[model samples]
Target chain A: MTIPLRTPDGRWRLWPGLALIAALAAGAAAASGALGRYELNVLTTMLCYLVLAQAWNILAGYGGLISLGVSAFAGGGAYCVALLASHTGAGLPLTLGAAPLLGALAALALSVPLLRLRGDYFTIGTLAAALALQAWVYNWDFAGGSVGLSVPIARSPDLAQTYLLACGAATLAVGAAYWTAYSTFGMRLRAVRDNEEAAAGLGVPTVRYRLAAFVLCGALSGLAGGLIAYQQIAFEPGGMLGPGWSINALLMCVVGGVGTVAGPVVGTLVVYYLLTTLLAGYDAVSLVVEGLLLVLIVRFAPQGIWPLATRYAGTLLVRMRRTA
Target chain B: MSAAVVLNGILLGGLYGMSAMGLSLVFGVLRLVNMAHGAMLVLGAYLAVLITAGTPLPLPVAGACAVLLAGGLGYVLQRHLLTAMLVRGANGPLVATFGLSLIASGLVALRFGSDPVSIPTALGTAGWSLWGLDVRAAYAVSFALAGVVAVALHLTLSRTRLGAAVRAAAADPRTADLIGIDVRTLYALVFAVASALAALAGLLVGVAFSVSPQSGTSYLLIAMAVVVLGGIGNVLGTFAGAILLGVVQTLAAAQFGGGYRDLVVYILFFVVLAVLPRGLFGRRLT
Candidate 1:
């Protein structure tokens, strides 16, 4: 499942991926003028998802946690930052700093006990944490309870700036994912993912690596959540901490390719686009489509779209070499 | 605060324990983390709601139909979808079941809408007083039913041929196959039984409280927490864990205001995980 990004043959598939992202960003920018407010909102949301999906990949695909509580981090970031911003005069910088910091602290605190939970237990524990957190947030008066907290800052109603900022965040998120995936740490992460016991037996410090991945994922998701609060100008506990967010992240990674740098990007785009475009008018259609995609991918394409494509490409290359 | 409140908690714990038992059963046999177990419970409630809508059928019959519908779904999915994923080892079924859960949720939402619907029952309004505490008959009935389900499940596992097959499958899948037991069929049965249990729990809840599309996650979380805190695949452990949770939540609500119940539950879960990783009853299934 190791995708060959660099080789003696030097196919350099990374360039094509970067080019595609750049082109999409540029195209999105151009469309900002022509697109309606509704369309812009969808695109911006897609970027928020991009950030979330990538962070989730870092935790589940790379690290062996398979956490179902990434939304906890995101929602924590959203509420923490939104509340601070509205209540204080710290502005966006202080709010943004608190988002990742609070999220990281939460990760550290949760992971201490949570890291002890492995596999399905870990997933369930994280989910319980998320649900509990959501309930807590909903009941907290400071968080605006069920009514949600609205940001006091003014912004363009057209959402062009928000979409553009989201694009940049998506790019950076993908970049961070690529950097980490190609690093030595990433190799260890894959090793851990493949077999934690085996990796630990080989002195892989599985717990530490897993914790690091969780924190990284949590921070990124928190940042995304903060950004979303900025864009939407509201931080609803239901919106941030719901199972739907977790599902979307898992769907994106699984559909595009789990354990790959580019997988979440592609998966998020496809899933988000399908929901916003193809199933635009239908109610509850997104859930069905995403659910079906997850089941199908887990059943049929556990290696995901990227690995499948590379396998086909390898076979094609072999055939070409034979002909030559 | 009084005998009835404590009694009510105990009764609710019965259903909670019953709700989580099927989940424990599935995990024990298939080694899958079915995130949709709560969704299954909700589906059961939905089925009960649908069946009881303007029907002359007795409450028990409607409850049975709900359980049956859920059991049927479990059989279909286990026989068709989940079995394929089981061949690949642990994580396959875990992810697949999660996906199935999402799909089920979507279907339920699409069919039922997001609105909360309560099952109308005269028993819910009826109650008895004992030791200066008020008690609802509906809660008591649901609780008693849950206890029966738990006892029945335990007997089935310990006494029945199918129970033996399931245990054999759980103990060693390949060996079970070698012994001429249909591992596939056993899993399907396990799923059916689990689904039935979930539906029963759901039906009980519908009669007692309210059912909605969004309520599944809370039930699922509590069930999973109970499963983990009880022990990964231990049934008796689930009963203990659910009761422990029921008490913890009820007490937390009583003390810290209802808002902090979750905080307390999570803290309790964390403490259990930190202190006893294998849960309070970590005994390996015999």
Candidate 2:
């Protein structure tokens, strides 16, 4: 008997997935002109959140690195765009292009000290880094101190352009996630996550894989932040580098389903519509609801809504066939 | 910096040590980082504030009540909500505690209006001069209280049979359970004790400084710094580390500006982590 080296689900579906994604992106772009300003803004925000959620999913779900510092990269990217636009007279495309590079560099610098810690220590380290970055920004006169700086509106992208940028970033994020879902790189990353000692015994370079994932996550988050900056012309450090960004990304991933390609997309849509849009202006109420949802989900539905729903549907299908 | 500033820093360090003690204890025993720790601290402060404002009880009595209440809440939470999640995985409890923190912060904000508030005390403006050094009366009392608590905790963990059981359970829960230790109940008790310690620290923090709904994360960061510097789970080490951090922060504040003190401390924390991941004192129970 021949033994299969990989699971049936491990087959790469990248080409078809890319085609579907491209079609969706094209459709969204076409519909953007018809969308009202409010709807366009909301959709743009959702897309940016989608990018962040996907990045966080890859790191925490697949890499087993639960980071609470998404804001560091996101805010760093936003600041990069803001600084370039305001001081260097960089146009939108250049600023956006430079944002991810800055984010990748920052991640590289941080991974030296941060990646040394393991598990919860790493999580706490990331939180510290995020908070430290926020504090530093508050004191940095070059970054406009606590008051924060505004990107020059003339050089910034309009709402439709921002939406298109967000869409492109979201598509890239999803594609990356899909690749990670099926690629050999992701399989090795998961092996390292599941058992570092075992993976190392198999000759996997654990640190290198983790560093790559971290930098990729940072780069994607930075791209999302650039889109956010374009969306909000007058951005402050508090709004940009806030814990809210981390919380939102975490909530989306946990609520949708971590470690799955479709999880972030579903999560972003559900969270944005259910908590953010429905409970707008009631910050305290929304926070309470979000917290409650997170607690209940982890306690009862730890696999998250997407995975749970899929499993339920699978069982239902089997039950129907058996009955028939 | 002046000698007075150093003295104040030492006093501040005492409070910092107290704030971190519960977190260290819980982490040491349960191996679960209570992300809601800062919120619990703020909750204690708010409880004390409410007790003083609504009732004629003395501040000391009110503070004790707040501590007990917080302990009870912690026990219930760990027993009912956190116990099952513990087996799920490392990320499970961490995420759950984070959710709890959000809930706590949101509730506090809803009730307290997000405005800064402080515990009203005669000691707020009172000062004491001892051995040619000036100290605030509140700081002096808080520092003494922290010392007493630390010594008591150290003695309890090392000298008592219950302490022995707790230590065994912490070292190996499966083995301890096989030996007839009710690890679940012990976990809850340890969590309760940690929460009480956090509440005590919170009360002290309220007396020494202003607190708002949003103060939890900042205090949590300070406690994390202390925990890391003192060596995670080391009670006395945490106390000493807090003092060191306090001194350095005060000196930095004096050199740069008050606004950059947090930045300086955070950088120091990162440096310490990079240099000594095991912490300055290394991890030990006492």
Best by lDDT: 2
Identify the leading candidate in terms of DockQ: 2
TM-score per prediction, in order, is 0.90, 0.97
For model 1, how does the per-residue alpha-carbon lDDT over A31-93 read when each residue is reduced to its tens digit? 778878888887788889999898888888777567788788888888877788777756767
Top candidate on TM-score is: 2
Displacement of residue B228 (Cα, Å) in model 1 is 2.4
- Model 2, B93-136: lDDT tens per residue? 99999899889888888888888888888887789997888889
Instruction: List model 1 lDDT by residue over B1-286, tens digit each.
Output: 6455566667667778887888888887788878788889989888887787758788779888888888999999999988888887667777787877777778888988889877788876788775667777776787677677777777788788877888889999999999999999889988998988888888878877887877777787777767777886677778878887877777667767877765776777778887888888894553
Residue B30 of model 1 has an lDDT of 85
Model 2, which residues run further than 4 Å from truth?
A1-10
